[model samples]
Target: MSHTLPTDIRLHKKSRTLELIYGDINYELTAEYLRVHSPSAEVRGHGIGNGVLQTGKQLVGIKGIQPAGNYALKIIFDDGHDSGLFTWEYLLDLCQNHDQHWQDYLQQLQDAGASRNDGMIARG
Candidate 1:
């Protein structure tokens, strides 16, 4: 399934949060999650077997979400990863799997002897 970020995105001015509305669903994206789990090829890889685990992003924040044409978004993180282009379908999936995905990230950090709150990560 393919999804695209809607053209009518809403940003909360005070909280610096974002809401990507597509039809009836609204995806609330934060700087932290977007930064840590970018959907770009670098983060997601190219096949069903390629998924890079990300860590040390508990404090990471979303700087902004810029539109990348009609198909994707250029999400700028507070930690400075600005090259990933997140497509709509991926974002939807992320929203759907948020709890599981976040738990997976946390577990990865724990297994690596790292801390998203303490600035450590896997060495390889």
Candidate 2:
């Protein structure tokens, strides 16, 4: 299936969220969500089944957003991570599956004993 490219994209620095409008759909993705789910090799890893779980990113904010040709975006995070190439399709998928993805992330954190706070312990 082909997804329509974003018509508008806006960053809310105070809320640390990105608002994307793609045709009839509008999505608000948080910085933490974007950071943890970055498509960069540092987060997604170099191969399948090798993704690194990201922690300590609950409050991470977007420092900037740049266009990557006509197909994707390059998001720079305040934490000095600036590698993820957020394609239009990926952004659409993230919007459509935000809840499920967030739940999965929470479960991963639980299983790994990690917390939203970096280097902090997760309590049972």
Compare the candidates by lDDT and give the number of the best one.
2
- What TM-score should be assigned to candidate 2? 0.92
lDDT of 1 by residue, 1-124 (tens): 3345464677663565668777788777666676668877777789886967666666666777787876777877767788898777777777788898778877777786777765755465
Q: List the residue pairs that clash in candidate 2.
A: none
Q: By summed lDDT, which 10 consecutive residues of candidate 1 come out lowest?
A: 1-10
Q: Top model by TM-score, which number?
A: 2
The estimated TM-scores of all candidates read 0.74, 0.92
Q: How many residue-pair clashes does candidate 1 contain?
A: 3
What tens digits encode model 2's per-residue C-alpha lDDT throughout 1-124?
A: 3454778899999999999998877899999999999999999989999999998899899999999988889999999999999998898889889999999999998889998877476767
RMSD of model 1 against the true structure: 3.7
